[model samples]
Target: MEDLLRPIYQERASDRDTLGILLIEKTRPNSPLTDDFDVILLIIVEDNEDQPWHVKHYEFDDKTAALHVVTEELLMQWIDTSSYRRAVEWVIYGKVIFDRNEYISDLKEQLRSFPSVKRDLRKAIEFGKLVKSYSEAKDLYETLHFKDAYSRMINSLHYLARLAVIEKGFHPEVTVWQQVRYIDPEVYKLYEELTESNEDIEKRVQLMILAIDFVISTRARYSAKHLLDTMGEREGSWSYSELKTHPYLLSYGLDLTAIVSYLAEKNIIKTERVETKGVGVYQRKYLVTDKE
Candidate 1:
């Protein structure tokens, strides 16, 4: 496969702006890692204002190839925010075919280290999604939608499992449950109870709802550290819009309402009502609690 991909990456390497190139071969049939393509050619280039990435499908000497033209800036954003989950996989598993000043090599080392700031951001984002989905699941259960609640609970658990893995200072891998099974068997057991238990859908959903609530509360302060820290940076309380739109928080893509509500419910944060245009009305704002 390298024989076929050599000239392609060579052509890119010839460009002055091209920083590095990596080749990720599909390890097995029907694998989604490379989108089932025979191979993936990841060409990293210097930042450009035009766009973040340009993707192309090619038939290189009859072997299917997926070309990803990504800029250094966008790649960094993806790594920081976990915007594109596969970005980590690419950097971790890719075979470095070309390197300019060992950029790709250093990046791999950085990811292996998994700095606390990046991990905290990923945790906060995952926790927000967990709270949102878990809340929806409970609402569904209240409405007697057992099957729907079960499916939502599955998603919620997936987020929780990822959260557990992140808290342990590891990136969630393709087979996250496999990682969770070893990292935190307790969460893996929750997954098993939800999926493998012989109980009817309603009972299983009920059981998970209670368990996940406790888990969320347990991790609330820790998982919300990034957001709480950001809010604490400024003196006054932050309106929901301000908190959600802040540049630092933007990367997390937070489900702001859900996170804020859960934090208030668990007393991790406090909410205040400020006077609005209407004399008797008020707008809600959130702040880090004094003790937090």
Candidate 2:
């Protein structure tokens, strides 16, 4: 049974020119000859789900007549498995990773392309909209909607949310990774290196958000000293002690020094030394360069 099955899969793997569905029918393991063509499987690349779940089948058939006749552009309908249901759920729930309203609105457009599923797709869309609204309204790390929607969809949604967390620079937690894996295990395997514990993830999220805010707020004024100083308050000038209190500086405590050095090296700022009489103290004052 393994010998016959392995060769067929290998043949399928090698045939890049033949794109579409591969129908494979195999006989029973116990009686390979009598049940020779008893099992049949339909393998089609699912456009909706990611690459791995692309293959789906329905019934089991084993017979010389049932060997998968392969080619591209041909779509396999189904065999015995709930591949269709899984595909539908993935599309509905995966939208949570992206903008929910926008995704559904586009889905409405995609459904129009396939006239057959358009009607059922619309009904799914109506329910999907409701689910999305609820998911978005909840606070970050606050709401967990795992049970309400279809299991496959919830799985996709959870993976998407964790991806958002990763993009925001906070590490995803093991539990978050688990949630994503429950939907698409492949994603977990792909991004396993970045995800961390919840506490670490929270800190990363805060840092990411803060960095973005800092960049936006400092666009007009391109000085690190100014960027660091003005991030928290409206005051014009802050003492060195008062400046250290800013979270912006604390976030990159070590890099902050290097950034200042870089600015000086670039001649963006002029650094001067002043000597105080008796105290013999040196102070550096920064002035914006003409190039800035």
lDDT of each model, Cα atoms only?
Answer: 0.89, 0.36
Model 1 lDDT on a 0 to 1 scale: 0.89
Query: What global local distance difference test value does model 2 have?
Result: 0.36
After superposition, which runs of candidate 2 have C-alpha atoms over 4 Å from their true positions? 1-243, 277-279
Model 2 lDDT per residue over 1-292, tens place: 3345445555554544323322333334553322344433333322332233333232323334333332112222211111133332223222222122253345434433434222222222222232233233222423343232223333434434443333332323435655555654644543342234244544433333333233323321232433333332452333344435655444334334444444455565456666667486866644444433
Q: Which numbered prediction scores highest in TM-score against the true structure?
A: 1
Residue 263, candidate 2: how far off, in angstroms? 1.2
Model 1 quality (TM-score): 0.96
Best by lDDT: 1
